[model samples]
Target chain A: MAVPSFLARERIVAKPGFNRWLIPPAALAVHLSIGQAYATSVYKVALVEHFNASLTEIGIIFSLAIVMLGVSAALFGTWVDKNGPRAAMATAAVFWSAGFIVGSLGIFTNQLWLVYLGYGVLGGIGLGIGYISPVSTLIKWFPDRPGLATGMAIMGFGGGAMVASPLSRQLMNWYDDDYTGAAGEVASGNSVGFLFLTLGLVYLVFMLFGAFIVRVPAADWRPHGFDPATVKQKSLVTTENVSANNAIKTPQFWLLWTVLFCNVTAGIGILEQAAPMIQDFFREGGTSAVAAAAAAGFVGLLSLFNMAGRFVWSSTSDYIGRKPIYMVYLGVGIVLYIGLATIGSSAVWLFVALAAVIISFYGGGFATVPAYLRDLFGTYQVGAIHGRLLTAWAAAGIAGPLIINGILDMQGEPGNLVASDYRPALFIMVGILAVGFVANLLIKPVAEKYFEPKPTDVPEAASTTGDRSLTR
Target chain B: MSTARTDDRGPQEGSKGLVAFAWTLVGIPLVYGLYNTVKAASALFTG
Candidate 1:
């Protein structure tokens, strides 16, 4: 497929002395837009009422979107690499915005399957492509600080919901006078349709702005005062390239896969049941001391921690190195889970502080992995490799909810359970984190056989840019 | 001496106005989002 001339990789190459700072905002535009995926919970009740569907039925919409996010990213990882960020970002914008438009049509017409097809399948593709679009480019541009570069961009993803959650509520309120923006008050279907239509147009403009402004670093462009030799000197940091195809064949990739799966699964154990879990933990004499509003506030606080950890910890990885950081995320994560299960209910502050740090480690694991891959595989195809690795997140997405929700279901119903009811699930997470800890410890540098036969680019000026050339 | 090569099109400088404009554009919404989240999260302590 030929890329439109305006969206071609060559068209957006950075000129000499181009500002690298411009690239982070460009990445933020797409991520912030797609990050709306997390805010679906805000309108979940409204959709259930409007569509007259079961909670499970409506929940599938989010599940399907996440599953597609992983699938499309793996499938299109190379295409994104082949096309430059401009082309990939533009395509993601179109698919994402169109998803909203189509979803609006479904809501307006009262067709459940249309909403699924539009939001779940199409919007999900947009999510995946947009997620990886800026990754390798950022790493290439800021080679001196790969963790910081990628961290700034990925943080936008965690922050997107902060904007969308409130924005969607206001938009829904504006579209419907009868709909009070209060807990349990559902918005009308028409209001949701209009909201989708409005978001679609709004995101399309922002994402296109990102696409037009984003630039690939000029061939032979290296940041001043940075040495590739300094990078090579770090243990497990490779200057040699590895094709994404060969990346999968290595044991290190799968070990990292297990590490991500365990981290995400344990985190989701808390996130999936954050509000209710807090209430249940503190329940006394069949009633909870924690107010509903306070529980909601706990969820909000966790989101803040999650977003901050992505930037703070990932940037910390630049100084500490990637492997050591995972030890912090997974190793410290074990002790936190134990604290939560054993004595979380003794005090609210203790419980909140422990859960906040655990969630931050979860978010840190995500932001740090791209830099981790760049460490092991080099920049040749880090984006595609990153895309492949996200399938673990998709797997954990299913496994996390299932494990927690399944255990909770077996114990008893909500509103009647106490802290001990959750001990089993929290302990299971401890086991999961232990497995990830071992996996992180076992990760060694890729063996020599997996290296591309010839190095793709040297620190010298002889090497040129354009992703296609790098892969070849 | 660092073996790294530099692109000699000129010193790697960028326009201050453009950089400021770009950051402000994205920064405003992010700040707005952060403010709202912090306000909501405060309920955990106060409530």
Candidate 2:
């Protein structure tokens, strides 16, 4: 028997093909730039030494950038959905490039506010826009492989730090001759200014490549043999589409937000103080500065697991479902944090291994959440919902560093951070993750009452007139 | 079903080269970036 007209329409809309290929590069372009957040640690030592800034002061820069990423994303997400990837990516390029330039000026003038303006305010907008540009489009193109599609893009965000960390380190070395300058001493500002300028120009070019290559799939496109019924079989995976505005009102959105917030906060607690945390933990056991630097390098190593887990774990979600995977992330994550609090410092490898697993889940949480949204809300406005959801990230950005550094500051000793000293923070993270775990369990499928389908007139017009069937 | 036949014929036309080129462009960067990341991370951790 022939399929019904409605089924045929659905098939065409869900079809996948060569166009799906375009989404990844489009995503990579933006992710690569925002991924620099991961490598911010590489700059921490340099900034502290160059500006004679305290750790708390330097951390404020990262906090501001992250908070901005969330806020700008929420603000721009709906606009991004309406306009298309081209406009969004182009705007991201402008703000991101401008951020670096502004930051360069700040560095040259010895103005701390400019640095915050350039890197935090300007760069944060770029991070938010770039992050969501390809997300919904890719999910639409690869409906059958939502996890993998989102994973491919998010993996770029995770891996971006791996490239940036080494590249930034190399650039610093290239620009400045004195790597061995005294701890916390200011370096010549000219070199730093020039480096920021060069980075800005290069990123502008790459972001444009992403903007240009991104194209919505032809109308009436559907995957070669897709069966929507199969998707219905996966309880955690939903085929229904929800607009971003409606998604915010649902219990599912808040639950997922809490899950992401807890996961991010837990990871950032260790991440923000990675170098010092490792040094202090091992110092009592007689590990030296060289060993500590190597351990810092191990922290960089976690970015790989972070990157890999984004792709591997989230892609695995396509088959396993989103909720169960998050269960593993939170469940295993709690155990890992508990181990770190209790037994991490006893052996260096134990610390490294447990830290790597926790970091992987941290990265996976980001990669998987978009698909989770796709499952709950449909594709209609998933991008905007994803964008709004980032506010949780912004909150965590502030809360994470504050919880970690605040505790450390209260202790009143610069070099005396030990495993015992970290107990309160670690326990806080454990409780936060547990709360998120409960939220994950509480998440129910978004009800139909919450979903307002896209205007039939608009979708019908596009399907009949536009070349891309998939986007329709 | 008629539309399916048309879709099949279009893929048979000029799409082969475009598909190959796009896949290569996207795949190469992805593979290289993943390889480079894993290698770098390994060196940092193991060394």
Candidate 3:
């Protein structure tokens, strides 16, 4: 198969005095767009009614996309490393947008399979590729502040849903103004199909900009005055590089994976049931429940903390060290989960504040892991390493929801439930956080044997500025 | 005394303005999202 010229890997001709800071926005462009996947719930009901399918059947689209995200990231991590961000990002741009386009066709035809193949399979692969493409590049550009750099890019993924949700809702309203019924319960396949077309094209443009605008740091790049030796002063942070395939062989990899899995599973315990949990906690035996919209607002509030934590907690890790940050996430996470279980209904403020912070740690866990990987493995294939670790996320997604929802199911229905109903799930989350805490405690430096041999050193600024010529 | 090729060395000067621009990519949408979400929350909860 002949690879299109656009998809072909071409060396980025680095120019002296060209800004290294430009890279994060390029990352944000793709991340923010892929973040739309989080907002698919906005259209979930419409699709169900339109396709005349069960909720479980429609839910498979998001499930399959997330499953593919883990699979494709693991499968394509090395490809991303070899082809560079440009090629990987371009491929993601094509797949993500095409997924939506194909999904639109499915909606038009009312063929559920096309929607599955388009949004689920193709879009999921895009999510996987797009997710990791910029990680190593950001780490390379901001060698001194890998946590902050990667956090900014990853934070945008959280923010992307924030943008997409309202925008999608408004777009649906605009296109389907003729319909008069309650929100999210009504149907407008045509409006949704058009919305997909709009989203597909818009995402395509944004991702292309990301691919084209992104440039990798040269072989021997570092920020001005950053001493490579300084990182050695910190225990467990290494200057050595490890290939992604080799990284998993070491104990550090699995430890970090456990850390991610536990943190995510605990966070999802709150997230999967955010709205209902709030109502349940405050309901006082279902006498006066927290309104559905307020519950939604609560989810929105958690998302803010989540996004903010990605930037704030990860940036703090730059100063406090990544391990210590994980300690906070795991240790404090246990406390918060316990508090929510114990005194959650005591006061609304306390409940909201505790949940928000827990959610922050959840987002922090995600944004910090890439930097954590870079510290252990070096930037050579940190993106690839991060990709492999994301399987932990996919695993957590299933486990967290199953445990919480399964427990909830053991109780009666959602609206009628009280705080006591969710108490078991909350206490169980404490155990889950405790496991992550142990994993964080267990994480130490990678064994030296797993590291790749060092490449020959190159002096910074040996290269000239304004060199635009491509070499493959 | 460097034998490493010129092309291998990365950019020398950092651009602050561009950094500010990059932050805006996150900042603008975040602020807007927060506003919208707050509005939605208030309307949903208040009346």
> Among all windows of ten consecutive residues in candidate 1 chain A, which has the lowest summed lDDT?
A460-469
For all the predictions, what are the DockQ values?
Answer: 0.45, 0.25, 0.33
Residue-wise C-alpha lDDT for candidate 3, range A1-472, written one tens digit per residue: 2245555444563455567778888899999999998889888889988999999999999999999999999988988876678888999999999999999999999999999999999999999999998998789778889899999999989989999988887788788986443454564988899899999998999889788778876554456667779977887888877889899999899999999999999998889899888888888745645777778778888888888999999999999999999999999999888899899789878888899999999999999999999888887778888999999999999999999999999998867888888999989989988988998898888888887764333233222111122222
lDDT of 1 by residue, A1-472 (tens): 6798888777777777788888899999888899999999988888899999999999988888899999988888877877779999999999999889999999999998998999998999999999999999999888999999888888999889998999999999999998878887889989999999999999999899889889988656788767789988889999887889999999999999999999999998899999999899899998888988889999999999999999999999999999999999999999999999998999999999999999999999999999999999988789899999999999999999999999989999878989999999999999999999999999999998888766344432233332332343
TM-score of each: 0.96, 0.85, 0.92
lDDT minimum window of 10 residues, candidate 3 chain A = A463-472
Chain B, TM-score, each prediction?
Answer: 0.71, 0.57, 0.55
**Can you give the lDDT of residue A100 in candidate 2?**
91
Give every collision pair in model 1.
none
For model 2 the TM-score comes to 0.85
Once fitted onto the true fold, the runs of candidate 2 whose alpha carbons sit more than 4 angstroms away are: A1-19, A44-59, A177-187, A285-290, A409-412, A453-472, B1-47
Clashing pairs in 3: A16-A465, A462-B6, A463-B6
- Residue by residue across A96-140, what tens digits does model 2's lDDT show? 899999999988888878989998899989989889988987887
User: B1-47 in candidate 3: lDDT tens per residue?
Assistant: 24542232444445666567666755676677678767766643463
Residue ranges of candidate 1 with Cα displaced over 4 Å: A455-472, B1-4, B8-14
Which candidate order results from sorting by lDDT in descending order? Answer: 1, 3, 2
Candidate with the greatest TM-score versus the true structure? 1
